[model samples]
Target: MKIIIILGIFLTSIANAGEHQIPTAPQKYLDMQNPIVKMDEQLLKITSRLYKRKCSKCHGKKGDGKGYHAENIEIKPAAFSIPDYMLNRKDGQLFWIMMNGSDDTEMVSVGPGTDIGLSEQQMWELITYLRKEFTK
Candidate 1:
């Protein structure tokens, strides 16, 4: 009986994983806008390299969330390439996630003081790259 109950709970968690992993952005972040107005080729090149180094391990090269590490991770990375996925999320939401990663998953804070330490401008640039390259 206990085993069955545990299995039920575990299965329920897996079924609802998506709902659990996405952290809510504070109103401040939610209200914020992307400062980057345009993405030049030079900026794209820089952010692409940054993405490859920091994000591709889990989010995948094509932003499909099927990177080599994705299989072993308990919670899957966000699939940015999914149709309208990037469109629905606010710029602030995306920025907040990168700045303060979800606590329930492997995504970590990549902004300011984190070990991966990305500047605000760099993070915004990455968001620009995501919108341009991954949005379907």
Candidate 2:
């Protein structure tokens, strides 16, 4: 039984090794930053709940990408806890991703124009929360 558990853990790591790559966002998005300041506690709360509502189902509550539906999906949710990954990705890039889902994966867009999607400001708020809370 111990061997089975150990094997399972090893296989899981192997399964995720080089599973996917973060695509390059356009130059326009790469240079952008969150316009809102980090000290905005009120807005952060709102965005936190929004993250829970829209993203936590896949990205996990703590931004670890181990949510309830994580195992059942093909595209792995990004592990935002990794500062290296999150730090390099600009706010605009992340915001654009939230607005327009990944082209090569199952990251469906959650921004405006969709029937049930986030508005521009709401998307920005989400990014703010991610940067302030998770990426630190």
Candidate 3:
């Protein structure tokens, strides 16, 4: 019984060691894909229009936090052009923020049933545009 338990522990340790080993070059290549080199112009136009209709009231036309309605609000909307703030956030995080606006800030969920009512795909497009435009 002692020998069996020792062998089991030894085998488990070996398996774990192998699992943590650095992956091969081919494996790394398969893990990642090339990023989209260019934005789709048609999608850009659609998202731009959506931004104008929904976001321009708070984020401004250029996403610089200078929208016409911004003066009345206590908390200023995020300036999307700021590289420091834009770089740390992931696309998924941005999507979540758009779908469920920050609790402390004036930003509200622009998703369905809300005043702005943006679809999931539309929010994704807006995220893509913001990431592309803001992140260097």
Candidate 4:
């Protein structure tokens, strides 16, 4: 009986975990794709560093959305490793979200004039890193 109860709890937690969903981006960005065809190995390394610097705080080091600041934030961060949901999203959509940030949510625009802004190229790099490292 004890083992049964523990198993049920574990299954419940797993079910609840995958329920967190990132809202969809606007239509314009929904069809966007990563335009960088010549992704270099060095750029991939730099992209990892960028995610650690800019995204890991709330998205977690593994992109699991359970980072240190996750508990305190109103909107939960996205778990990039979620295959089913993330795979359905276009790379361009991710780029736009990273660029403009989600409104009424903790996701802030990491482009320019913001606390975590990145250059356009850098944004693309970050997106590339995210897709490569996570979302398998």
Candidate that scores best on lDDT = 1
Clash counts for the predictions, in order = 0, 0, 0, 3
Per-residue lDDT for 100 in model 3? 73
Cα misplacement distance, residue 110 of candidate 2 (Å): 1.1
**Which residue pairs show backbone clashes in model 1?**
none
Error of 1 at 5 (Å): 3.6
User: Could you tell which candidate, 1 or 3, scores higher by TM-score?
Assistant: 1
* Per-residue accuracy of model 1 over 57-100 as CA lDDT, tens digit each: 89999999999999998889999999999998888998999988
Better of 1 and 4 by TM-score: 1
Better of 3 and 4 by TM-score: 4
| TM-score, every prediction | 0.90, 0.79, 0.65, 0.76
| C-alpha lDDT of all candidate models, in order | 0.91, 0.79, 0.70, 0.79
**Model 2 lDDT tens row, 1-136:** 9999999999987787557676667888878777766546777778888889888988899998888889888778988887676777788788777767887676888878885478887877777787777884
Q: Where is model 4 poorest over a 10-residue stretch in terms of lDDT?
A: 16-25
lDDT agreement of model 4 with the native: 0.79
For model 2, the stretches where C-alpha displacement exceeds 4 angstroms are 1-19
Give every collision pair in model 4: 32-92, 110-117, 111-117
User: Could you tell which candidate, 1 or 4, scores higher by lDDT?
Assistant: 1
Q: What are the candidates' C-alpha RMSDs? A: 1.7, 6.3, 15.1, 7.1
